[model samples]
Target: MQHQAFLDLRTTLDLLKANGELSEVSGEVNWDVELGAVTREVLRRRGPALLFSNITGYRGPQARCSRLATGLFASFRRISLMLGFDQQPSNRALIEYVLKKNATLVPPVLVEDGPVHENVLTGDAVDLFAFPAPRWHHLDGGRYIGTMGCVVTRDPQTRQVNVGLYRSMIVDRNRMGTLIVSSQGWGGHWGKYREMKRPMPVAFVFGWDPVMEFVAGSPIPATICEYDVMGGYRGAPVPLVKCRTVELEVPAAAELVVEGTISDDPATYAPEGPFGEYTGHVSEIATPRPVVKVSAITHRDRPIFRGTLEGSLPGASGENSYMSSIQRAAIACNVLRNAGIPGILDVFVHPVNNGTTVIVQIKKHYEGQPKQIAAALWGSNASSHRYKFVVVVDDDIDPGDYEAVDWAINYRVDPGSDDIVVFRSTFGSALDPSTLLEHRQLSELGAGLWNRMLIDATRTWRFPRRPQWGGERFPPLVTPRPQDLELVRKRWREYGFAGWKAEF
Candidate 1:
């Protein structure tokens, strides 16, 4: 029988704490840019997840920045812990588990009077500045209150639930300026509201289970409800509580929830940007954006605020911190599977940039057939619109094993013939340096349509050698005389091989 699911984020954190992966910090961390930078460095260095107890500049009688799960996926061991997976499991194995659960989605259960409703603020009493809104970078426009928040929405027409991870900037003590991409469903909702000349209803929830948080930020199929996906992720149904002011449901044990309405005036632009982006570069342009008016705020006592710094590629936060490429990879894999690609090892969309570069590995079947697989990959829906650079290799060439992939690329492919470039495709990445606003002045008009190269990096059939080399058949399958590995294990103590760690 499956184990009973965790009740909430606190329960999950307790499990993590018992496992020695979470560290409680009493450090009086400044909630300004300092905390953001420090937390990022800690995650980058592969330290334990931190729970900052004291946050400066917040006048509330409760704690701030109390919980954070960082570096949970930086190592194999931690990823295993997060997924309840065995240590030796490959990425493919983990993804298979994820997919299986995704298909068995259980809708969230509703409950009343959970931890998130312990405190309530409405109308004039709602002061977002009371919380420690972190000024993540030096050049940022202002403090951001919702870098870790998930915006919940339902399609006006279809009523299908959608959750988007958008950065919410604190425009004042009560107003939040939000930026969302048009490619996502949140953008679709905003468009619908504009067409009807109505304010867009939105609710932002923070401090939920890490798996639920990740699901909210993932690229789940448009047909899949994000809430149901979160339930699938946890291996059980999620428990939810209705919001006080908005007609939306949030995780029952969430630390905080803010309900609001999004403005739709084109002329009501703000001087946004100059914040550090995932490309590891500071942005220069200032653009108008939707301003969110907070009608109510509700939370658990001693709420936690989570912050992620944004910067250029491979810099500090942003792409790497947000795990955006993980979403891209998941989506790509799903597409590949639907296309009947067999023995897929893994799909990795490198961070710091958007889905520009995609690396995939699959177990090759038959001979001279890897190119057929590579061609399908080049034109696949997932790879076509976004990825500008794609590399296909065999399972022996692990996509994560960069050194081996580079070796395959060096050995295969005469660049002129092996590299195929397709042109005039839609490409819109906020972190991409080449991406610019189109002639319509609409940010969604998207300016980065150009050629994309898909390279056949697997071993080629062409020969400086035989018709078959390094394949399943080489030397009539020469077999090594077997010495019992079990015998060695039994005799290791006598051979002074007691050096192996006994912890396992």
Candidate 2:
């Protein structure tokens, strides 16, 4: 991996542009309507994101700016680059990188000032509306500004840093209604402070390297601080600067920084959502979330507005953001390895409704053994407790290859013998539709256990058999000739493949 220090959002935009991953537009775009519509249309076509240069209703001369560059992490090639791996490295390779670097914790460095501190707007002068906030969906309650930003908070007792990528909806210029699922680590920290009747400090950072954005979404264990993990992911200490108005440190090169205090009181319930969640559905959750009375808003000159959609479509809540799913699978695989599972070749958790559903696969070692392995997988620290469904398969099956896993599921396993539903022990996410019940039903159920179904999709047998793994016993490997691939690259136009030409 190379060290590419981005000085500002413009530099990050330029890098995306130079890599042919950005779309440029010169028309007049509106933050309230046009920006959201265009992004939806582009994501529908699975097209590159556009940067809208001229937004409507500007105080100064109609400024040249662009929006929506590299939405949904766009490409696997880019994901691998972001993770510091080869173009097409396997999940195993990714896990190796994580384990190798996790021990050498690279602490973040503090700086006096960076791009984020360039133009500080303190107290009443700070207006979040000055920037273009996108109203992504028609049914969305409000325009969201921090879809791609990292919310930085720390434990009130331990002071362990927690970073999460939660949405920030613009309520007014000075106030944004943040969605906090209090069960989550970051939210739990705020809940603890709220119990003690103390204000929780928070700093949200927009527009840093995409790697930081990814880390913001990662499930870094409670013991390890995300800032340290961000440092590991970057292969260098992330440069952070202390906020002038809040007790928080933000990325020095962040395009925009928001500093505020979270009011920790359930009595202050705000009518939060009808906004689209990661699942393609619109749901309402009433929680006493942090009402950030913005102490300050800081940014560099001409800071680019960065965003992503989150409602059940590609680039929003869709499969377009497969990198995180892939990363989650990698994390699960690591957990299994730590548990001494053998013949674990690969794993993949695919997004259904884009990212709401998870399908996990593990290589089968022995006949009828896949059942035991499948059940044990539910105990794995990374995914077992949380995933909706987990399927176990043989090495003959490619977990990441959706087609192969489907074939195994259809032809091999009989549900009567292979499918087993374990009760009372599992936990699930709030986004799960089946878990939430009516108030009357809740009285009977008493907070239901999220029942996850694990289908032992690997081949079942009548008798014990040897594991079909190792050297030549593994499935025949296939790869295109380097010369042939190069030839196809040069002659792709003649072969009627336009996308390839654009890709190359």
Candidate 3:
């Protein structure tokens, strides 16, 4: 069982293709809307990861970067592959793996040079449109180049670095419009810079090991740098190179790197979004957002531009959803552990909502355990946009089974009793469509307000135990005895059910 990281995007793509998990398009596709539509359609069909080699206006010999790769981590099978698992691992297995890795810290090592510096463009040579920046949605404000890119920043006082996934739209040839909420990882760095009245140096890293994206997008502790966690995933020191124009370091093998600075000055603000977010809906309309003024652009020789469609649909999703399913659940469980809350057996996040709702299976330890779970999850910085709905079930229930969770909710949860809990006006995702526009205004509120809900699906312990209840607070479920089930299993073949297998 050797688990290692795919050091570069090329190797990762090759492995995906060899595994029959990636599909390449040789035909030319328009970058305007066609490319995004194709990617979305593939996700809808649960098809292979995509590689568009022939995009319109990007096929000429002089093209800087022609190929585009998206949806590489859109499925559990692909994600398992990224984690070095030959066969698709179970959800529980992946969650446990992520939990351990998230806690491990292997600091990155500095490298004087690498592939990212093969070509460096500064001042007039830098062009944001040189690579294909897809207009993922027709209603989108503009082409977003940093949808899946990692944004690197550092705290002014402690100088503790943070790598986060923040959306960026091409504002001009050397400027990008971005929505930086004060509640996010990078937002905290921006605030420290703001207090100092100094522009924040920033770098955007694209296309390296997918582990960079995996760790950067997660809600790891503020004290631990994501590069360290990424190193833990790789089982080696992550080699990083200093950015030309920023005080941050990026993966040495990253396909492309953009270095720049962001200031709070109104002059640096530009009209930014209405982007199709991971919430499956467009957020606030185009508004003045802090913009990154590019001072330098660096890349590998004939770099492969990496980008992904951001929105998640009913039957379709992308890398963010798949990655979050494991990361969010593990992070939540870690939060519970830190709070000293016991009885947590399993945590599950359905890809559809990307952890907006979570299900936790636990052994009943106390009457108010469900409330404790909700409080601990909400209190954590990781819950800024997650764990909005927490459902706690008994050990007998499986969190992954929606029907089982639903049944538990219906039978065990009494709406008017303490079984249901709601935490109002808590910090949450500004992009949640359900959140009122006024609540999402970043200018006023630092974060969105969510009325969080907790459905205690476990059986109530307040009831007195009777002779028929077998000394238990709650009545026993109407299930066949273990010996009775064994008898049925043995006689199932003799009872004219030879073709069917009894799994229970």
Candidate 4:
């Protein structure tokens, strides 16, 4: 079967509709908390994508012209469809597939015109509140307009553009505040601008091609441009068009683009968040962050606003963190493979675990190999500092299977004997609530310091019961014999078992 490119938000929605994966809510909805409530319910149910045609509150052109969409990439089936896959594969399979396909780089193509320029608001006419930006959670400080969006910025020295998925909260008609962790790429860019005492030009894209959303949220290497990885996913260059006010460029078919400049002055900082974050917890405290002064608001006529429920609810659905975990796993796997780590079979990063806690499956060839693998993972860029737990298992154990992993940890691991390496006061995720401000230690990069643990769950020795039973002679797993299991699997359907298919 031939596949189609999910080039733009409209195209992706159309595909979803055609596949009966989209749900339309035509009744009038409020932007304050009603929309978020509904979106939360839908996501909790693992329901279809929502397209709200009518929005209440605003009485201008935006009321009639703007719409809202949520749950765009909420399910495995939706993700598979977006990636142009023939069948919905297991999470591990999908990650491996994406890693392999993304190997081929495809640069973006510049375009003169696109649908995003159908209507443009520049200079004094720019208004950040033109659309129905949802107050996603009741406890959120304000309506966030850039939850499912990408913040585009360029480095001052390198001039290399970095597209990051930072939540932007609308503060006023022409200003918005966005969180920038000191360790993130955008933070690095802003840090340079702060050092230079110059405002950093930024473009916030609310609705663009679905591929852009995925790439923006991905942990792409700082050296490789996100657009290039986006192109690789699309199997072609992502079409781009120059922004109206900013020096940056945006996806040509973007639904809404907010061009602005992030003030570098510390005095310009605004109280940013008390918002319910992806960690599924509302930070009791808010912090002062740089605010973006909108210079332009460009979009297609009758544009749709895309939003995501970022807090704990989506995490419970198991859909929210899937992509991030997959991408992080791929990065970890690549790091290990490139370092000449042998017998590496698979890698799975637990999604709900704050994108930390990586599980590695490897073929055990020698003693102390699992410890080496764990150490390599801990030292690598993909896992170092970021990942909190590293668990190494044998190839037979599926990394994606938590139950299997648990069994391996319980049986193969000895807390005292097996290596459980711990590195103290290392850089860690700021979102980790465990790192209290009072007890927090800061790295030079401003990352919070925390301890990381590595568990070597892989079999370390063959039969230690006897010296004669040595070398590649480990006791076999207690289960049905391979040939016996195969025979039973092959004829299971003939035995008249219900829902017993060969593949399952």
Candidate 5:
């Protein structure tokens, strides 16, 4: 598919509107739990991306920023459009497109300055609350300013630039407390900074084209810069401008840019979390984490703050859920290929689990292939927060279909056989409520622990071949012959089920 560049939020919104995928909520809406609740309802209904203009506390003429955008990726259609598809594409198509684009890296082009520098606020003049950062959940610790922020940072030694989607909450006008998992891309940078005992320079790009959020939020390999990947998606180099207060570059026309430095100093840490997470639960506790020492705030005039209601609830999934489904599956497949593992036909991640469970469909090349898939995934950085439950099925099964997977798991998997494997006490998501509290302690363990599981739902090769079953190791699936199905199709009304309007 040809790529179309929508470099900024304004143009992206225009595209969304033109495609009838956007909705402008001109009526006054509260930025508290109310807006979040409304957004959830829309997500449940699979509605359009919202442009909230008349927020209750942010609509005044003197308001620093009055508009906000959310739910741009609540559906496959929106994500498909972002990928330059004229219409909604199947998950396989989406994954294939992403795999190709990820390999096509084009580094960003830096200009002297851009619209992000149109207005700059520093020192006492800076007020993070001036923008309509929302307390998306009632239990949220504070107004999260960086729900969708594409955080930009670099390694001190290698100078390798990284852009990631890490959550940040407003602690004060100039201080934002954030969670930086040691297993993530930004966390790797934080570790080096800790060793050197220096503050880590950080730049938060709050809003831009949807692709920024797409790549930043996924595991796109640490060696490849996200900006380069973004450029590849746009079919051109991303225009960038140097941040005023940090040695970082942000998209030139980003809606808002928050520049800061985070010290490893324990004294500067602040309490954060108890917010809704993508796993469909509230982060259990408020723990003191690294806080950003905001040095400056730069943006275009009347900037629109970007954030998302993070949790994916029953029948109400959020942006991260939709985006992760395609990217994580593609990334997982890529990981297996890179590891030289064979017969990885396709991979699928259910939106609800947000990549926690990766379903693999393979051509069944050899015995113990399921264990190999689980091992490779668990050993990869892409499995930091996901791939906790890896299910392997034969090529006949559709990984995307829960029913087919369930059927395969029931029949193909022998309960007492070597079809199930569990790797205990491995690194995983700290916010997983199922994990014991003691195991989830970041202060002590530096990361959470999970007992990962692998279910080999493929037909077992251990079974003896039988001539009665057509010389197969396992019995073939029971179904009517092709001639019988065609006969029924020709005489459908005779079966007295013509009221059911479907092909035989």
Candidate 6:
């Protein structure tokens, strides 16, 4: 069966249910730590998507939208299904699919009306707590309403629109705060607005189509609008509706659209987080962040709130890490190929490491090719500086197979001769737990320096075979010949192993 673009969250959920990948929970749950705890357990067990029908302690307008959804993209099979693949795809296949689709840019189409405008609240009616916002983790400073949502921003000078996925905390009625990393797209826009001495007009969209969220979080080029990439993935223009208050356009079928202005006044800043981040740590301390003064709230009636469980163990398998890894891997591969780095076969960013470690497979054509690949990757635009470890292996080894990678590292590498290029004083991720308090303090002051290691595990060359290089035969690999392996595979069933299969 062919897969089509899902217009909204409900349609995506319906597809998951039809495929037997979703489960509904009728029991009333709390928006506090209880909901997050349950979701974490489910994600750990690789369980189905969850739909919480009843949420306790949420009354009045909030009670109308008591339903919440979580764990939508926990499995690779589910991700493949959402991406319109015929069957479950490997990480490399998924990355290649995105890379191919991303080559063509498709702009979004603007419309006058959408389900998000079903009810519009302006002025005093705009309450940030009207929905069931959850405190996803025990240590989080407050209830976050935008864990799975997209924040919209635009450059004042260039007029380039950017949609980014940043965690947001509800401060009060008509007020929210979001954490913008120093290197993110939205942060650049915010900096531009700050230089222009104007408040940044922004909108937070919740409960959009699954593909929309993926595009928002992916590390696309800064010049390309995420909406265009969304259209490319969907094979059609994404329908957008103008926000009631902000000048931005939001997903037409979004469940909620919060229009606001990020205040430039330092006095309006508030403590945003001690929340657990995707790096598997709660190392980020509570700090003052820019406040967003909400001007309007618009939503569909009885909307479903989508919440993502981020940080540490649960987040490793969560939507953000999974999608980011795929996009990063694709970007890393493209960067290497575009730079004319020869023999780069594949790249895999470990989901659990959150891009801190990357595995690269290459066909070694020369003696120093592995070191060259490692150096090229470190200097690429794929955020290689943040990577603590970059492993280079032969094309015969699968980068995603940890066992094979480990074997290559153990046997093919001699630490003395093989390169372990280490660079000190480089920018590191703020969420890295290994970062010392002193280092973090320095990083906060514009000196975010750390160390990076690159390991070359390619097979060593003992002697040169070419006459130009003083003709001496090189030792052959110890593995069985290709013909012998083919004979073994062909006679596997005939060898009295009826239910067994051989993997070559």
Quality of model 3 by C-alpha lDDT? 0.91
- Using TM-score as the yardstick, the better of models 3 and 5 is 5
Put down candidate 4 lDDT per residue, 1-504, tens digits, no spaces.
Answer: 245564688888888898988998988888888888888788777789899877786545636255788887777788788788667887768777778755656888899998999988877777777888888788999988888879889999998888888888888889998777666778789889989988999998977778787778866767777888888876788888999888999998899998999986768888777777777777535677779989988898888888887765433543446566767787778777877878888888776664577888988778777767766766654552356888999888999899999988998877886557787776666666777854432223365566888888887664455444433445566689889999988887678868665553
Off by over 4 Å in 4: 1-3, 58-65, 312-315, 380-386, 439-445, 462-477, 480-504
Residues 369-468 of candidate 6 have per-residue lDDT tens digits of 7666656766653462245788888888999999999988887777776556786766655556677756754226433456778888777665447665
Residue lDDT tens for model 2, 282-396: 6455433457768899987777777776655534333235545655665666666676767776666664333233444545565556545555555643442255566777777
Model 5 Cα shift for residue 152 (angstroms):
0.6
Best prediction by TM-score: 5
Q: How should the candidates be ordered by TM-score, best one leading? A: 5, 3, 6, 4, 1, 2
Question: What do the candidate models score in CA lDDT, each in turn?
Answer: 0.65, 0.64, 0.91, 0.77, 0.90, 0.79
Cα lDDT tens digits, model 5, 26-127, are 988898888898899999999999999999888888999999999998888888877788977788888888898888899999999889999999999899
lDDT string, candidate 3, 1-504, tens digits: 466754699899998999999999999999998998898899999999999999999997899999999999899999888889888878888998999988888999999999999999998999999989899988889999998899999998998999999999999999999989888889999998988999999999999999999999998888999999999988889999988878889999999999999999987799999898999898779999899999999999999999999888989988899999889999999999889999899999999889999999998888889899999999999998899999999999999999999998888988999888888998988999998887888878877888999999999987787887888877888899999999988877677655676653
Candidate 5 residue 481 Cα shift, in angstroms, is 2.0
10 residues in a row with least lDDT, candidate 6: 440-449
Q: What's the C-alpha lDDT at position 435 in model 3?
A: 84
Sorted on lDDT, best first, the list reads 3, 5, 6, 4, 1, 2
Model 1: CA > 4 A from native: 1-4, 59-76, 86-88, 311-327, 349-356, 364-386, 436-451, 461-504
Clashing pairs in 3: none
lDDT of model 6, residue 269: 90
Candidate 4 or 6, higher lDDT? 6
Q: What pairs collide in candidate 5?
A: none
- Of candidates 6 and 3, the better by lDDT: 3
